[model samples]
Target: MKSWSSYLKQFAIAIGVVLLIILVMDYNIRLDELNRLNEKATIVRAQATQAIQTQVALQTQIAEATSDRVTEDNARNNGEIQEGDQRVVPIPATGVPPLEISVPTPVPTRVKKWQVWMELFFGE
Candidate 1:
């Protein structure tokens, strides 16, 4: 009877040891999964932030496109003029265009270092 009880106790200890090992392996796997999920969440947040910024930029562009100034500029680009604005017709002059007078830049002559030293000593 003592031998039977001893065998049962040894069996229970063996089962406990195996269960402990399985639990430790499961905990490690769960920890690794949690880390992977956190990394993915970080990436998703960055993408969401970029998407929001793009949305804001698009909204700004939409607002600017609908403004009165932009509309007027577009109309002018399409050659539409407002009422009471006179269109001027320019005639090309047969005479020559006026000449621009520019002062000539003096050319600097480079001298040798020894010539410079000779000038410094004897150019008095």
Candidate 2:
């Protein structure tokens, strides 16, 4: 009877140790999973914020597009003219370019030896 009881006690202790080890391992796995989820949530939050900011920027641009200044600029870009506006269409000169005026080139004056000597000494 004593030997049997001793054996049973040993088995119970071993079982308890194994259960503790399994519980600790499960806790570690759960902690890792929780951290991963938190990081993913942070990333998703940032993406959402960026999306909202982009939405706001697009709305601002839409509002600006409806303004008078933008409308006028768009019209001018499309070559649209208002009433009483005269559009001058430029005609390209064809066949030959306008005759260029010819001017005679002035001949260079001769520098004397004394003048060269004076310039070399004075640096003028």
Candidate 3:
């Protein structure tokens, strides 16, 4: 009977050691997971803060866009002349001719692929 009790005691001790090891491992895994979650929360908080700042900035821009000065500028850009306003076309100085857009003449030159490769590798 004494031997039976000793064997039982040994078995219980072994089971306790196994359970302790498992608990320690589970605790470590849980700690790692908690650290990951904390990191993710920090990232989310930063993103949320940035989003709020962006929202405020966009609201300010909207306010500015709707202001009287902005509206008048937009109207003027669209060629809308207000009351009591005279449209004056400014002419260049008498010596300077009006600027003319000259279309570039297309140079019709045919080159082979090998010539293009040679030009790319060397010089024009």
Candidate 4:
């Protein structure tokens, strides 16, 4: 009877050990999945932020262009302005008339393949 009890105790311990191992493995898998989900969420948030910023910047540029056009129209209709005449604004202390300067379009920076991949995963 004593030998039977000893064997039963050992069997129970062995079963408990296996269950503990399985539980630990399951916990590790869950933790890994959680980490992956968090990383995906972070990437999505960064992309959204970049998109919003780009949209806002484009809107601001359009608004500025429209405002400039309106100002030019108003000046032309102000009665002091004549057709085919250039509006020369005097520069302070510079003996030179303020000229309308044409801004050149900026050249796009070259992107490396690896950089593009990183941007896709991590965003700018």
Candidate 5:
């Protein structure tokens, strides 16, 4: 009876040691997983901050684009004239009149059917 009890105690200690090793292994694996999750969270936070900055910049651009000054500048660029505004085209001080451009009429030449056939056969 004494030998049997001692053997049982040894078995229990072995089991306890195995369980402790498993617990340590599990703790290490969980710690590594937690580190990876923290890195991912930091990356997500940076991305969110960049998105917010981009949104603010876009909003500012929208406001500027819709402003009255920008509207008037765009209108002037598009050759729009406001009320009570006189548009004066500056003429050169030289008395020479602007030259007129004339397009020459293209003369059409008639081709004979026999010539066309000869040209096709000759590869010209």
Candidate 6:
């Protein structure tokens, strides 16, 4: 009877340890799932920002293009001008091409990913 009771106690302890391990494993799995969800959310937000920027860029380009078209149309439609209208001058093309503007292109500054992360976390 004593030996049976000892074995039962050992079985109970073994079951308890298994349950504890299972609980710990379940907690870690939930944590991992939560971490994955957070990462996905971050990626989704970045993509949304990028899409918004792209849409804004496209809208700006369309507006500029439309303005250029309107200007060109106005210039073409002005057939008979009364007074104070600027005369359109047609310059004869010479053998040599006109000199191009020599404005220097702006150079992009180098940025590190960690710097961006730090700026995001630390407010600049």
Give one clash count per candidate, in the order shown: 0, 0, 0, 0, 0, 0
For model 3, how does the per-residue alpha-carbon lDDT over 22-48 read when each residue is reduced to its tens digit? 999999999999999999999999999
Tell me the alpha-carbon RMSD of every candidate.
7.1, 10.7, 6.1, 17.5, 10.1, 15.5
Candidate 5 similarity to native, TM-score: 0.70
lDDT of 1: 0.96
lDDT tens digits by residue: candidate 4, 10-119: 99999999999999999999999999999999999999999999999999988886896777887777845668787888659767887899999999999999999999
Highest TM-score among the candidates is held by which one? 1
Regions of candidate 3 where Cα sits further than 4 Å from its true position: 84-124
lDDT score, residue 112, model 2? 96
lDDT of 6 by residue, 1-124 (tens): 5698899999999999999999999999999999999999999999999999999999998888689676677766876443676767798798988888999999999999999999999974
Q: Rank the candidates by TM-score, best first.
A: 1, 5, 3, 2, 4, 6
**TM-score preference between candidates 2 and 4, better one:** 2
List residue ranges in candidate 4 displaced over 4 A. 68-124
TM-score of each: 0.71, 0.60, 0.64, 0.51, 0.70, 0.50
**Which digits, one per residue and each the tens of the lDDT, describe model 2 over residues 39-102?**
9999999999999999999999999999999999999999999999999889968997889899
For residues 1-124, write the lDDT of model 5, one tens digit per residue: 5798899999999999999999999999999999999999999999999999999999999999999999999999998989999998887878888899999999999999999999999965
Candidates in order have lDDT scores of 0.96, 0.96, 0.96, 0.91, 0.96, 0.89
| Model 4, TM vs. native | 0.51
Candidate 3: give its CA RMSD in angstroms.
6.1
Least accurate 10 contiguous residues by lDDT in model 2: 1-10
